[model samples]
Target: MSRRWSLRGKEIAVDDEDVVPAGLPERLFATDRFPCERINMYSTIDFLLCVRDALNGTEEMAMLLRSCFGTLFRFPVRRVLMGKVIHGMLTRQVLTKKKYELWPVFGGNPFRFSLVEFGEVTGLPCDEFEEGYSIDYELPATEENYAYWERLIGPDRDATIADLVAMVLGDTGMPASRKLRLCLIIIVDGVLVPTSQIQKPSLKHVNLVKNIKNFLAFQWGRESFAWAIRTMKPCPKKLRQKTLRILGFPLALQLVAFELIPHMQG
Candidate 1:
């Protein structure tokens, strides 16, 4: 049934089905969408899911994966720890090894990667592998992603995470994704020198139900924070130590004990 008339300003309503509700955060992203690659909340896992779904010919699953980004892209910051983790993941992406060097299908220009210098074998027998390798990059903007990120963030710089959380929670009119990207940039660069990390108090309102570290530890389980720290930037010793502790020194020790101690002759 058709509505009698659509109200000009008030007719539009929130789609009850969508995860993110209609709100100011929606308006913010609507103003200017993120230009570069935007990862799903599950990120690499989401990419794997898309690839898996595509393999299974489940088009709708790809759509579902596309829709699963973290809610921080909307209004106030909710999952602070998740936000930080995402920021770390994005930062890791920021400094990715140039893949085009290995796979010419990226199509920008020929370049060499220090890690895998195979020289110019453009017309050689080895070029067959490039075709197989290119299959792994079926998604759009596969390598251009690195270029877009390179432009958005510079090496040895700080991302705007704290300010972003502050803005989203405050009365600011900035896009949440943009804020998160800025934070990612800082996190990517934050390793060089530790700026004041996000204020824990500000995030207290977000996940009050669980202890943040415990929750993250449950998720990270056996992984060490060293990887995050290395990507975020090397900091002062105290800051590094603090990061290690926050990232999960106890869990790390447990992993080491379980895997290493059992094997040691001592």
Candidate 2:
């Protein structure tokens, strides 16, 4: 009689005399879900399996990626979609980390998974994206497509827009609230866009300059950018850098949405 425990969400067992139904593969052991929960353990593959299971029976991932990404839209499609996707993917993993740090915003390479994978899977026309990092891609407008998208995205677009902005900002060095404000500015100030230009990109839609700017003004007061800056506090160097890459680099996206040429000086 030996006490057994599960490991890494996998249904295997540990400790002395941990045998299964006696006739199974000698290499495998059995641990029931109740016991596993009692011991608090799981396998990495088990975790992935769970994710796979959750995503079963539908192509939501592909559809969301395609809808939010693909051709440029008048709203920030990638921004919104990326947040939801990352939130779904990372919340579980984040809970598992023994040592976790929660900043006002979450910033790191972890949030970039969907974008990186999307491009690889779609075989999209990313010609303009080759020369720069994730933040430098652009989204060109198409009037007919834009109108179709507007009708398709519908009224909830604003809520979705806010989510993406928050996620990206959180993934950056800025505070969650500030990330919201700053992202809004970048959207309207003509800094953010969804283009294939980034070495790896997350956003698949673009924002309108007037809409973004006006959104910023309403969201952040007259000194919105400056006010958002005030909220910045110190984080560890490693975390800070990660945040900047996730949040700051995407500032290049603003240029695309606005259709501005980066090299030209006013």
lDDT of 2 at 24: 32
Cα lDDT tens digits for candidate 2, 60-122: 323322431222222333343232222222222221111211111122211111122222322
Report the number of the highest-TM-score candidate: 2
Q: After superposition, how far is residue 171 of candidate 2 from its true place, in Å?
A: 30
lDDT by residue for model 1 (208-228), tens: 112323322221211113222
Q: Write down the worst ten-residue block by lDDT for model 1.
A: 116-125
Model 2: weakest 10-residue lDDT segment is 34-43
User: Relative to the unseen true structure, what is the Cα RMSD of model 2?
Assistant: 21.4
lDDT of 1: 0.25
Residue 219, candidate 1: Cα error in Å is 15
Best by lDDT: 2
